[model samples]
Target: MKHLLALIFCVYFSGCLMGQQQAEWGNWKNWGDQEDGTYLNPIIPSDYSDIDCIQVGEDYYAISSTFQFSPGMTLLHSKDLVNWEICSNIIDDLTQISESLNWTRMDRYGRGVWAGTLRHHNGRFYLFFGTPDEGYFMTSAAHPEGPWKPLTPLLAEAGWDDCTAMWDDNGKAYFVGTHFADGYKTYLFKMAEDGKSIDRKSAVLIHSGSGREASKLIKVNGWYYLIFSEHKPGVGRYVMAKRSRKLAGSYKEERQLALPSCEAMEPNQGGIIPGKDNNWYFLTHHGTGDWSGRIVSLLPVTWVDGWPIPGEVLPQNIGAMKWSGKMPFKYTEKLSIKRSDDFDDERLAPQWQWNYQPRKEYFSLTERPGWLRLKAYRPLEADKLLKAGNTLTQRTFRKQDNDVVIKIDISNMKDGQKNGLCHFSSQHSAIGIVKEESACYLEYRKNDNITRGIPIRSQYVWLRTQWGLDSKSHYYYSLDGDNFLSFGEPYQLVWGNYRGDRIGIYCFSDKREDGFVDVDYCHYK
Candidate 1:
């Protein structure tokens, strides 16, 4: 209540642009990075981890890891580092990586695309990402919002993750990647002139340290800086920097640049981007977090004696700082990922992502003029919703309560088909309606346990899931749009498979792939 009043006061007295306020993607009051000079810790208060940002002219393009989500490699663009909008997704189809993504087993939950590095070189946008089990891959496009050329597998061997690409002043390309096979070691590999293939014979040890990964190569003022992350005793995940005059050998010993932060510990594992004014900033993710997962934070970077310090360094080399400081660039506009979906448009919003590569024929927006029609298909197995394909999902929030409402039409549902909205994670819960032999019933699934057979005569009903910041979830249902009655026990939202909790709309069958559900709209507030 107080927060709402405070939000109202700030909206009124602070002269926040009404258009910008109306375009907020998530909770209004918790939006980070204010227009004032000083910005907050989390520039984005959601799970946008394994982030890498590159400055291309005055525009900034950033990419985040999307493990199994189809249209992977979430690309975000910003005029200022503080404000960003979803620009594009580099990988339009997960099947391009492996057909296993669409397998009946429905694999590749946390094993698909990992941390990626984005860079602009010679008027082309290049992205390099790795799979923990499938080695490294590269893709390129003339524009950041890309019809990115298909993923070219650079290295087919396993045990590599978090790779970055760069080209030296001599026109020779090099790739910096981490190999976990022989402990945590960062490797430097020479790349082909085109940057698609790496010379296997040119692999060299760049840096090796405990928990060291997220390797990136940055050149500044004739000195080459190799940035990485490490986990130390009692300090958590921290950033490390090593520098040398040359690109390959004779690098300096690692220096601790930043330490675990109180705002969200383990403020680690992100690349650095410089402002147009030449001011540098470190883009990091808080490794320690709740159901919001690893949220992103942008910290001020200062170069002291050739080392890039993330945030402010404390006395006695204790830890790095996490405080709101002066913005490196002017905050002129506000942007966010589009969230709400009325299903009235020809396209789905950027906030919508499939659990994996969705079968194109299983879902449609054009089939039903003004609704999202999800054709019900049998689960890969008996009754596992996680294995159910075409589950459209969006990230949930923390630090504030989130209300999700979805109106599902069951008029076309068939027996043995269950279609409704759910909160999904390692442990998931759903308040959905099921069509049985002769009638429809409301059902609830908590974890693996489920309760069904609550009769509902309506052909259309509204389902609601209230996700509290404290991780509690309340499920409700309504025949009419007005009043909502709590149906199930409070389910605790959880984190699993390297992802935060996601509120998703799913339609699957236990019998046959012969049913469908028309969703009028899904509203999140």
Candidate 2:
């Protein structure tokens, strides 16, 4: 009897331990901090593309292209290079820059706010970015998280992108960018000290190739390194470098710096910055698009004979891609980019952004105190998810399987209003409450196809989307918020408009605009 009791106790103890371990680590899909002094590749497994990072004091600040998403150019802050969080968004109203970015137009799908450079000099932070149609624009702030000055047009000509600026030792500013319309030709020009304008008359053609772009200029050890990406015939986009003793002209022949691996597609289009320990590191995004978009990775850097080589150095001075390495700094706290919102705060979390410049009158956090109230509005294009205005969204993580559950109150929903959760790229899938006449029904929409389920009489319903590594999503709806029934067909997530899949909460009406839904909370994992 004693032996049997001891066996049972041991079994119970082990089961509890296993359950605790699963609860701690099982749900997370994209945790990079190993917690053992090492970190993994794709430090951020979301769609933060066209990245540029800089070290300001002990804190590291990085920025990424937002494309058509409003709050253009996301800015991130990190204590250690492996752990990052959204600090702020540079452009709050993208319509201020171009009317094409307005929700009514929604035309700048893959073109607005492309690759940019972030630099801190003279006690201020400066950001320079360009659009394919709007040429180049810049903004500056006293701090990384800031009241940024209104964007000043640096150049108003089209066909230019991927702009970087550097202030030399003598305080002379220089700008480098690529002109895609002109055979991918790269040029260097003198920039004004204020960084508000560029001296186009000082333009000098530096490099030209079949598909050369993503220009970054930096000075290290008295050599000005011009780093960019060029398309290889069959190998995809790869990082290349050209060094010159002077800022202009006569650069050495380009050398291959980093190449794509089977796991990381095309390690290109990012900046190299010195770590806190004075060692250099390269933060880049995989150029090739996937369901997760261009995910970010941090590569170890080695200075070989005055050249900064990224990843493992191979023969002929090329860097082979790596998957894991020692942590740049010994940061023990596990940080995440995922958000769980309770809707109690006065402001939305930094991770949230509208599909475009939202019509602020239709969204309210104060309307219901502890809930997010989204009033329905007629979309510019009727019955189109992509054309809906005021849809709040955030990037979906793709490292492993993940899920999101949102509780919404549909009591206030009016006829012809659709209120629910959705995940979309170019195409979209949604599971939500669709009201018709005087009854509410649960509807699952995949692109244009609609599947209506039984009538829902509840005031509140919980909607969930579970997505796996296969890039497929399954949706569920629950009345009690405990037991959930599958609602939609297996929807495949996709990469489009140069963006990864984004999960959003939408409330819109195809008819009148008097309906509304209150989102109680959103739990994402």
Candidate 3:
């Protein structure tokens, strides 16, 4: 069983990817990767460029780009504006809109659905999103685990998109969306009561919308502040604002609070969630890895000189948020899900999901009394990354530079058979494996480049992905002992299509026949 568990992950890329390299004749485990514990700007992980977040009631929620990956809109929740975790993703499959929409397999490229918006009103949640290359859409569900209604195009046209919305105090609803290209030009309009469709004739272009475009309305003490931006990508776009006496009136420019950390990303329009207590915080992000590594940041909004400013640095409210700031809110040191999978339960954890809508027979270890069996799907091509059919994955939410371990016990893995683990976004994915030949291999693919085939001794293979704020990533392969072989370069753990990397396991086949792989445990440190 141990060998079976190990061998399943030993199969490397179909070809030898361990290109010519100097072999270090030392204890393989000697090449241990450790976290420097250094922190960088845009604290949390994500490249969800066109981002929009909302604080509903006491709980805060957010959504970003899914690009080609169906079951889109990775939803997030947070108590203190800083530390956030995945709550539920809204889509199960793109079956309703365009079933053939997956560019993650093309150049394994191009953006899918870019910027997204999350809005809550009258006890229901609303999500507005758009594929920059496709068109704009709006979908909703009572809860995040959406039976989400079919997708509907919000605007008559859809180029590059950024959509923002808010429910005004006088029982009125408004939507502000923008089109992107050389520069962003925005228009404000009223939405139908249902919040799914908008009044196109009511749309009005309010800004030059240069750089990036976005706007959200939040009023306080009778003053209505229109938050918008002219965020030019490189030169440090400002999170400027305009104030109007009324919700949809002519306003004036405010001020710039936070700038891009590294000179690449400037401040763009972040969603403003007005708390029940009347205070507001801005949910936004900045660039990290060469326009690729962008992450989410949060801040309290403070008004000085008649303009809004992000109260503290970035994510000044992560985990241990202050109630008033003078007296610290004392609680536990820190909190995060360490590990789970007592598959002893009847249903799968909320965090686990197949690539798209999955069926009962597709996978279920219960039949094997704790063995995970995933039917074979397809030979993964560059164009159908997640669409390769049966990819079961989860988001890597922890911020620590940790290692992930998965236990697999598969029987006959031969004749175009495949069973492996993966860290996937839209375009980037990787795995460590034991193929039918009994040889162990570590395989990884990002965009057009695939680096793989570093050998391991035993089939009991442990493949790990590690990174920190610096976001430099390394893959390590280990056998019986904790000793591991470090393969691949220090590839930055940047965003792929429109989201961050999600790790899980897969069983694919060209025949489209379902194959099964049983997994025991998965430990993330």
Candidate 4:
């Protein structure tokens, strides 16, 4: 097994070295390709973890776990698996699931909608996810980019996570999920024809092991294959599979399909999708991550004696694998997540996500014609950005370096209101304009410590934050859009709650709820 893995890695990387050079590395938007058909690992440079992918005809849709960001699930679309774009979202508001998300006293953090499965079944798209605290929930849409229906709680019981749904050959439907409450056992339960509810009495213990979850049932060549990931002592977490002629019990032997590479220690938890040519490929995430969070990668899967071994299994380089491969399909065009916003559109871009279920009445794009108008509303309880409701944000892309700038018109601001641009996560830093009873001042906030009274003479200010690959963040402000000046100290951007940091635009008041700010534009480069 190890030799086969090494051979595969050497063959692919050898091909990659022939055309790609070192100087071309570190560009996030163009990370995957040599521009000559070969591609690299971590096709995506940012944290797009816990992905579930499905191929519908010529198009592919992948959804990722978004912990507390409103519009719970991130939907991505791709023509060739190497390039992807943020296309749509699964849920509009998470308050539909639990009011605890909206409670300023409590923040879900890294505990909201988690690892989910996306499947195209019977003319509709079904997406299912489970929260460790809130049990299982499912939502469907006739179209992937959709006006999706409200969420339906499949089971009110907690402790179940990483679920997948399947329909067998006999027209019988089954739901497979893992129970964390009972020593991490994978269970299979019968489901109604409509796939809305599970029959608990028909549940059977199919697999039991440590760190075993993300169970997916696939039928190929007259066999029911149970694919899952498990963690065993020194081996770390690896993908495994078991097969049977029947759905109930008495499944066959298990096979270790794939292991971590030296560069990617935990390349676990993703889906298998076949290409247009009928070749199989595995889309998984590199688990050991920096402050930028887990990044997703695509690996080729070859069947040896009916077992799918993804990429190479290199024992000598236990933490390394082939970093590039020939494109599974012909290249169409390069694509990536959207970062810049002109605020000229009638609807918010798919890239924008609220910190939580936003107070719908506090923001508007049409109010100022070409600007995003955010009304300042006092927090229900907490004063921090993590718990502050209705802050619009998006993930910070992990690369060599990046800059974010936003122009805010604070002429509409009232006394005691603060509006600013922030880099937010469990720990956050912000540079913004704060209005006091007598005057306005520029403030820098980090670690709950404030350095205020840096007097700025204008109501219109451009706030900027630049984050580097080293995880250092620098702040600046400009009265004129071009002449920017540095401020305070350099802040360290960090990650928490199973999420990377986010660039956020926020508006809120300490005394009243009627202040407002008009953001003319936000640019990312």
Candidate 5:
């Protein structure tokens, strides 16, 4: 009640945007220099950032950052944290997050899965996430790899992100997450017993004291432990643990949690579960600079008299932990990758899908012919509202910083046939090209200097985009197959009504007669 009144007072006095009342994503931070990948940049797979995990039986189920892509929750089941694969998305049923493909901060385009909570209790598995821009949502299933239920948006205090769940022994349930709508101030709260809502009656803890507060609650040895993160990126000060006899107060904080010794410190939103061996461990996602290609990192947790301690930090290495593909006789194991999609395949790889309602007739392909044909007839804007879709992108947040280059050839094009590459956040500012009557036109200038549609002479042109952190992105069109030309401005990707980052391919037709872009093949190099 007081918080609500305070929020109302702040809104009236601050002239801030109507929201959770905190400062968020737009904060200026320069993180483009971590390009060398030489120094221990622990955040390698920046694709799935801000992770929450749980151990179910012998398997470990984890979820992470989704700046709003379809199938919002990327669910992975692993035997060993080393080798991971997509089992199912916890949000397969929610058309809003899926069809809307709501992203993070419009600047964080095409990113959908963020700080998801995955757990299994009494034969049922539940997955929860903070659509920071849209409150909280969750789903459940009989198994980790399952036909997850539709996304259920829960009651969340305004101005919050990274909401996670917990169950206390006294038959009480709780959810925790923080928001910074007010400049940089962060606050924490508890969820209701039903788990579908944030308990307004519960006490609130404004995070003004010791640690980075994307916190997790765990009960061990009859005492409750609060394991948390301090916001430093790759360098240490990342993880910490606190405990209290009661749920709301009487808590003590640990001085230092992890000691990786890097230049960053963004150990955020975490989860813990007892393995089959009864050994407890910490599961977290490490931030790769300011770029949100979040990666999954595991730490075996140690506890002392109910207080949780993060385990030893592993040396940083990229895809270096090569465990056997599928091992037996284990506490946690990895599943085979279900992400390999061959455009030649008749159907879209179960894992690869469009953001919203896909006009299936617009696409065609033959396994024997080895090419995917998309007739470009509809104007890209008509198919996509003031939002973004009509493009093929992937959940690349936890995958880390790497240039993705797509190569495809067009057999022919009509004056209305517009097809090219897209790095989208919203409809306002996006970059791509349209081949009209054999001449290539870029979607630029109108989008301001952010993304300009430049026209160049050529029957065949190679369109490329270099998307990176610090909003560092560039578009290039090469008329001469050998060299490339940089377009007018470098797009600093920004999210729209919501927050997200998207990298994909788009084709549209505004004419009554439909036409399309027949992509011979595409390669991510």
Candidate 6:
């Protein structure tokens, strides 16, 4: 009896400890939820750019662009707009769109999947996104968490972006998009009911201007509203909207909806979603590019004389940004974007993505239990880290400071193989092991510059990168799990390829595909 009682106590204690650890891990990053009936701005301080959101019966879903990354189009779910969690990724294999996105080529950089839309219609979830080189493509699912149908190309012509779809009351489907090939002309095209094709002859010019794009269409209270973004010559990007009683013509002259707040990046290019209590909110990203990418912010929408004004209404009818406000709903669930991974699960975390569509055979989670095994292979371009295959990555969230640490087992490393952790945009920096001629040496690489450190014989090492508000990154490594020693010169993280910095684990061979590394764990905070 005493033995059983002691066993019960031990199990209960272990469970509690695990629960505490998970709770702690979830709160490691700067989450917007204050847990006290109000939330903060930059709701998600990561690279979830070019966002579009919709609300469906008390639940909110938002989709963001994932350019040149495998598992494109990240889908997020939330009870309130401020707090969100990764629910699904719409595109699992980007190579379906084009082979140029494949791991071997590494061709597309800033140009793969651009702005798109997400809408729920008639018990189906539909997504439409575009590539500058490959035109527009879409996919649908019966449920948001889905076995999504394969992508179907809707338009084969290029130089189009920011595509959105709407089904009218009479069930006539319409598609709206911007044609950058012709100086930012926004057009409305009648789409077939099946959504597989568009009648090019039915195109109608809705709005046209210099630097006009990110168009969204919605019907509210017998009015058709078209919201979009335009770049001012000296002022940066701003949000604008026009409304009409008809979908095809006679939209009023566009009015300014929102602009940049004091010292903040321009607020532009997102969705306007209605709240549960007839209130409304605008989900937008800061348009000016920075090292943190385009971080998202939530603004309160106030309808003034039939115009849904986002944020605080100021002179000239533009809305001022709000940094914090009452929760859209009074729910208490604290959600966060998943970051750390233990490599114990059979599948990769939804937050993780390869730099491009990776070669499936080059990576495995089951090869070594409780570890992620990445088989080394030669990059398409020798000594080019960005051209390497199977580099697993996730967005770097902005905070006062952020740190990422990973434990790597290098016992299987071969000569000419490099295995380590990295943070990169166009320029990247990494600290890892370089196996050369029967000796293992610590190496720090910043772009094409390589700094070789002392020789080491350790079979396992812990690599870390620390970056802060300045967006400068410093790399360190440790033979033991603790006592890390800095190795590389500080690298300034940049905004490139339409993406912010990403932290990743990489393994690549400069010569042959005969080496591998096992990453036991990754902790980000």
Q: How high a TM-score does candidate 1 get? A: 0.91
For candidate 5, give the lDDT. 0.51
Estimate, for each residue in 82-121, the C-alpha lDDT of model 3 and write its tens digit. Answer: 5456676676565544544532232223455566677777
Q: lDDT of model 6 at residue 112? A: 90
The digit string of per-residue lDDT tens for model 1 on 1-525 reads 322332333334225433442243223354466666778766787788888888887888888888988788899988778878889888987777788776355787778889989988888999889988778888999987778999899999888888888887888888888887778788888898798899988888877757788887889989888888776553356677788888765675657665444334567788787876678888877776567778787887877777787876545332354546666677556777666789998778777888888888888999889999999887887678888888999887775767889998889989999887898877788989888897899899876578874799887899998876567889999999889999878988777888888889999998988889999999888
Error of 1 at 448 (Å): 2.7
Off by over 4 Å in 2: 1-31
lDDT of 6 by residue, 1-525 (tens): 322332343344335544653343213354477778777776888889999999887799999999899899999998878888999989998988889999978899998989999989888899988999899898999889898999999888989999988888888898998899988898889998878788888888887775888888888899888998877563456677888887765786567666534234666889999876568999988777778888898999988778878887765455766667888886666778989999998899998999999999999999888999999999998888999988999999888778899999999999899989988888888888899979999999889689999998988899999987767898888999889998979989889988888998999998888888999999997
Candidate 4 per-residue C-alpha lDDT over 53-147 given as tens digits, one digit per residue, 9 for 90 to 100: 88888899999988778877999999888888998988887877787776354468878888888877888888888888888888888999997
- Candidate 3 or 6, higher TM-score? 6
Residue pairs clashing in model 6 are: none
lDDT (CA) per prediction: 0.79, 0.84, 0.55, 0.78, 0.51, 0.84
TM-scores for every candidate against the unseen true structure = 0.91, 0.93, 0.74, 0.91, 0.65, 0.93
| Candidate 1 ranges with C-alpha deviation above 4 Å | 1-31, 316-319
Badly placed stretches (over 4 Å) of model 3 are 1-51, 102-110, 144-148, 181-183, 252-269, 274-280, 288-292, 311-361, 365-371, 380-387, 395-400, 423-429, 434-461, 467-495, 500-504, 510-514
**What RMSD, rounded to one decimal, does every model reach?**
8.0, 10.6, 12.1, 4.3, 10.2, 12.4
Number of backbone collisions per candidate:
0, 0, 33, 6, 96, 0
Ranked by lDDT from best down, the candidates are 2, 6, 1, 4, 3, 5
* lDDT (10s digit) by residue, model 2, range 1-525: 322332343344335543653243213354577788888777888899999998888788889999888888999989889899999999888987798888778778788889899999999999999999989999999987789999999889999989899988888898988999989998899999889889989998888875999888888988999988877554456677899887764686567665444334667888888887678899998888877888888998898877788887766465756668888887556556757889898888888988888888899999899999999999888888888888999998875768899999999988999989999988899999999999999999999689999999999999999987778899999999999999889899998999989999999999998889999999997
Pick by TM-score: 1 or 2, better one:
2
Considering summed lDDT, which 10 consecutive residues are worst modelled in model 1?
Answer: 1-10
In candidate 3, how many Å is residue 27 off? 28
In model 1, what are the clashing residue pairs, if there are any?
none
